[model samples]
Target: MPSIKAALSKPFAKLIAKRIKKWASQPLETQEKVFQNLIKKARKTAFGRDHNFDSIRTYDDFRKNVPIRDYEALRPYVDRVVNGEEDVLWTGKPIYFAKTSGTTSGAKYIPITKESMPTHVNAARNAILMYIYETGNIKFVDGKMIFLQGSPILEEKNGIKLGRLSGIVAHYVPKYLQKNRMPSLETNCIEDWETKVSAIVEETIKEDMTVISGIPSWVQMYFEKLIDKSGKKVGEIFKNFNLFIFGGVNYEPYRAKFENLIGRKVDSIELYPASEGFFAFQDKQDEKGMLLQLNSGIFYEFIEAEHFFEENPERITINDVKVGVNYVMIISTTAGLWAYNIGDTVEFTSLRPYRVIVSGRIKHFISAFGEHVIGKEVEQALREAIANTDITVNEFTVAPQINPSEGLPYHEWFIEFDIEPKDESKLIQKLEASLQKQNSYYFDLIEGKVLKPLVVTKIKKDGFQTYMKSIGKLGGQNKIPRLSNDRKIADTLYKLELTK
Candidate 1:
């Protein structure tokens, strides 16, 4: 007998197929009009009344009236909502608060109300659905989807629930998928990531999994465990696995390692989901970037990342964005975030269907000597350096090393290698050269003797994994920042005795 899940997926997939086509062909004007309609509806809420949302008629009016806010600026309102305050930020108290690790400021508690839950749930569903429709691959529904997720057991904070975003998303997983999901709820609630992964490996080693999703690092950990437990390659153990879904970090550095483990290349999807909202996802297999979600309830705005630090910086809307320019993202959503800066930076790869490639975070950069090196530049540098080499860098992080006693300041790279290169010196030289080519300012600083040559530090085996475990940020939706303007994280890693 055919599975009910499989049968139900056929019609749901067909519906998503049609909707994605219509959504892709949707005009910018139509999307803007729909956004305005949403704003009109929100204006009746308490938050709207306080912000004079009723007085807004046009996008221009909305922008002029609402000052762009960072997570810190919105923290006051969020605190109220957490402390049993209703109709403050949203219509009522949030159903849950999506807890996230701090960028630099501190940890955040983002509200997820009844209205906004669907945006999280449907956006994720639609990402896979769109991929299924575009690629004509629906074999996943027939088998199982093993989402490497956080603990579903939520903690209560003054009558309000608090948990990781991935955990909260699991709560809303479709009933049809409940039977096909893995690791068991018992294993998922294990707070320690390593223990949880071990339990998951033990439980799912014999299951026929068709799809898997999580941050590439954690998934890679799981893959290693599976190989250890089964004494077989991933492809051999799970022959039916076809789709790999991932987000929260750059997938380039890990791609080669993944292929080596599986013994073949598999279709994969990339997503841009944050504590703030699910932003975009890779829709078409052939496309260079993920398509932006225009009709999602979130209203989007952008500020040129270069000008973001300037006083009275100009804010640009979705219709005005140009390709290749890095922009800091701001959003106002149904969850009561009004013109909130989410701290991410992205560059549009295509404008026709509005596709974007996440560049880096607003705070994730090294500019100690005014060189302004961002995560995009670092990843590009690594990609170019490893392009022709036999190197497989497992994970890496960059931070500024400034010490007047040490003479000159320079950027330091801490890398964990899965497959070491035959020529380590050659690889380092290539990495430095590529970085200089990517950031002219960094090159200029080197020429002026204001900074030393880039330093490469080989991290201990499983160094990053151990560090993440120590900090309790070890699983889904949590990723180590690739770059930092300061040495806090680097010093901490060094303290863990990881330096080579």
Candidate 2:
């Protein structure tokens, strides 16, 4: 039986699902409309005048007049907004800044406008509603749902608020769902992730928990804590737990470990969200990728990932994109990001309604030896190698061992296993074979004897957690990149393992 709120929300979910299908079916028209509105909004602003947004009549003119820029390139305009200036990037000041850690620039402040803020909340809400419309399971709505995220506490700067995107979103959980949300405000405010997860487990262990949402790695930590305190698997502790919603990182790598912890299968929905905007989410349970949010106050652009580093690479809209090609995603959003490169690479899975799967990051790849192995390829290799085996991997990362102490250098895999496999040598063969299949460059390098067979370095239990803690990025939206071009993290992991 559903609660009164759940009963009412069910029909409304169906209605919105219909509306979503209507727009998703007309990707080009929906995006054109969003593009027009963004240009109209930015025409009077400082960035608009400088970029000549006034004379931009079509995507061609807009692309020519505005150059694609990363966060560092656009920081001059953002510094103005941070210093209490108005109409610098977009119309008026941003309502809030989504703060995230940056490697070179320190903390990055991404603006969230009055127009763009609601889309974040609505997209997250509609993701669940679309799930209900498709599956007809609103029973989860009648029970508690917990979102493991950063502290909701925010800081005021120049009459505007700034905080982690997840924490900023915590303030916008709809009123009707407030009673059903877990981890008391006091509990959420705890700064330390270990303490926060402990408090969350204490609060939710006895409750009728039906839904759990967060990064899978952190959620795994929380689930282990619950099992430790309750003396039962998560499925046994919370009989009604039915849905898992996750984003920020690929969930495939953690799926097997989660199934072991839960002791049963549960439905899952994947989402593609960022501080810039809620870009996409899983609208159909059976789909391979998320439905691109065409009408959500964002205009999308793409450039072939291989050509992205070249000056003036072709930038095309959704109408021109094809399936299965890796492309770097760019956006001109209502939040006033103009031709902004969000640093993510995506591959299209469907062209009719424009569905995409995140392939990798533009900068995060291993090309040290001319074998540009991507995040997707490495993850797929690991996933394939672990299939049907007793291995359940907790976490893993890849880096090129450029200069090894031994023979020829090769790719080094740092894997933390929840259930170690019996045959380790066979596992490496499977992994290397899979990678060679997906990447021709890597294959040539391996076949040519330019590199040795990949090495698998076993990371001690909680080694990743310890590494993250040593660097002050323990949890809460922080994730280790799947691969890197350098040993910044690889060397650190080796040191952590030595101390352990």
Candidate 3:
């Protein structure tokens, strides 16, 4: 039976669903309006003045006036905002800064202005509402919900508050769901991730946990802690826990392990949220990819990832996107990012309503021999290899071993497995077959004897965790890249002093 709250919310959920469908049906029109609105709003800002936004009458005009820039390229403008200048990037000073790391530029503070904050909060809220409207399972809405995230205790930078995007979003949970949210504010403020997870376990273990949300890797740690403490499968402990909301990494690789831990399959929603903007969310349970948010105050452009480095490479809008093409997604948002390259590559799975899947990172790939292998290829290969096998992986990464000691150079797979495969050679064959099937460049190289099949170098159990802890990135929105062009991570994995 549905709780009174869940029952009452169903009517509103249907309304939200209808509204989303209405806007999505005309993606290009919605996006064009958003683009015009963004330009008009930012006309008085410093960036707009510098780029002549008032005179920009078309997408081409806007493109010619503003160049595509990564965070490093835009740092100068951001510094002015960080130094407490109003009407610099956006209309007013940003209320919050979403701080992130793992880039060559160390820590990055992305602005979250008053106008842009609600998009982040509502994107998350709407994802769940759409799910409830479609599935009619609002019972989960009544039970306690937990979000495994960073410390919400933010630091003041100039006059603006600075924290992780997830942390900043924690401050904006809708009023109605406040009572149902878990891990009391005190426990959420714990700085250390391990300490936080333990505290979260203590706070959530006895509650009616219906919704669990976080990056899959961190949530796995929390579940392990619960299982260790109670000696019970997570599903048994929290029988009503049915819905999972996750982002930051693809959940396919971790799906088998999660289902095993929970002792059953559950419904899940994937979100594409970053410091810059909330780009997309899973709107349908049966859809291939997330529905791109065209009505949000963000204008999108995409260039083919293959030609991204070439000067004068083409940029296209939603109206020009085609299914199955890998594109480097770019944005001009209300947060004052003009033609900002967020570094993510995506593939369009559908064109009618603009569904997209995050394919890989623009800079994260292996082309040592012009094979041009990507993150999605490697992840898919690994998933194919372990399917229907006794293999339960802990963590995995792939890098080209260009200078292996004995033979021709090949890709080295550093896999940390909880349940090692009984037949290693067969697993490797499956992986090689999948890679060859997906990537034509890699297949051609293999056929021409330019490269060899990948080799698996098993890392010790808990090895990746130790490496992350040593480097001070053990948790909180941190994830290992599925593929790397260099040996930085590969070499470090070999040198880590292990605990097990």
**Candidate with the greatest lDDT versus the true structure:** 2
lDDT of 1: 0.85
Q: Each candidate's TM vs. the true structure?
A: 0.95, 0.99, 0.98
lDDT of 1 by residue, 253-275 (tens): 88988988887889999998877
| lDDT to native, each model | 0.85, 0.92, 0.90
Q: Backbone collision count in every prediction?
A: 0, 0, 0
Lowest lDDT 10-mer window, candidate 1?
1-10
lDDT of 2 by residue, 354-443 (tens): 889999998899999989889999999999999988899988889999888889989999999889889999999999999999999999
Candidate 3: deviation at residue 146, Å? 0.4
Q: Which residue pairs in model 3 clash with each other? A: none
lDDT-best of 1 and 3: 3
- Stretches of candidate 3 off by over 4 Å are 497-500
Candidate 2 regions with alpha-carbon error over 4 angstroms: 498-500
